[model samples]
Target: MRDEKWTARIEAGVEGLTKAEWAPDSRNILCFSEWGLRVTIWSLSTGTATYIQFPKHPDRGYAFRKDGRYFVLAERYKSKDMMGVYDCPSGYKLIRHFALPTTSLASISLSPTGNHVAAWEAASEFKVVIMNLTGQHIATFIPTDDPLLGVRHILWHPSGTYLLVGGWDSKLYILSSLEWKVVATIQLASRLPSSTACCTIHSS
Candidate 1:
């Protein structure tokens, strides 16, 4: 198996580095840089690249929705306590701006279904908030303890029934959409024998 994987990698040389995300159709890959503030689309088959100058901002992050129709572009200001989102392919249409109750935006994640967004803020405390695509606050889930680990990543289950949050503390949290409660928590390093050690939800 290792030998076969290596052979495929050599044949695919420099092909995968052109962009950060491959198009839903697998024809192109979308790429961007936080420092350069530029967005580029690269053709996977032809190796051609097209670049677009991104709007000026101190910090920027983007997520491509599953349908490939639009992208969520988040911008953080240098001196302001707010963040903004742009709805694309309409590019830079101010969807909504929210004032940070804290100091900075810790991280942002868009659900796979494209209906919701999750954002974490880090300041003297840690907080996570969920919002709808229209920028309305849907629900807010705050852990009792600071999780001591900041939110490193957030992902939505394909069924859109749950959100998985991974933190620097080496823990994974599975949250239910309907109840908005933590259904399960898996510790990073635990040798305990339990059925809840692994959590899996089937989406039909």
Candidate 2:
């Protein structure tokens, strides 16, 4: 990475901008407008722009596939939480859109291998739904027997072997990629997920 003076400038929307980040390709900038309204993507190469509505969360509600070819974002549509997958290189077209099975959907992420997506509900419910590219439900994982207090975060390992999930209940759940089952559960200190990063287990 090199530091260089940039000349490109993107003007904000009528509602003004909340946050902006470069797309995986490094040529496009995704600008999120205020109040979770819409995301305006400005392409530097093509000098073109595109927009998508109802981005659920500015930061964690969207993720790009590892290859940077497919883009997915969580949305709030007609009082329902939805997920939309877009084709980044194909003029940012809407390739797939469907409603997610959750009331308060917090975050949605594409797996490292690009074979599936993992999404979870916020609040006390320990509901994490796994689905394929076509919006087919592969599995639903509930780590605890009873409901948890809150879901802090969920991330897929870069190797695509394990999915790390944690919550306010102060526990971390490691799920195997094979069946999406809870392979191991680890207890944590009062200060949690932020401090826990990589966990290695030699034996399953």
Off by over 4 Å in 1: 1-60, 81-102, 122-125, 190-204
For each candidate, what TM-score against the reference? 0.59, 0.86
Candidate 2 off by > 4 Å:
1-6, 191-204
Cα lDDT of candidate 2 equals 0.86
Clashing pairs in 1: none
Give a tens-digit lDDT track for model 2, residues 1-204. Answer: 999986898888487888999998889999999888899999998788899999999777888888988998899999998989999989789999998888999788788999889998887677889988788888888765564476788888999889998877888999998988988998887744744757645786
- Encode model 1's per-residue lDDT on 37-141: one tens digit a residue: 565666655666555454232243456677666656555455544445544444334556655443466656787777887877653345678777666777877
Query: Local error of candidate 1 at 86, Å?
Result: 3.9
lDDT of candidate model 1 versus the reference? 0.62
Candidate 2, position 195, lDDT: 44
**lDDT scores of the candidates, listed in order:** 0.62, 0.86
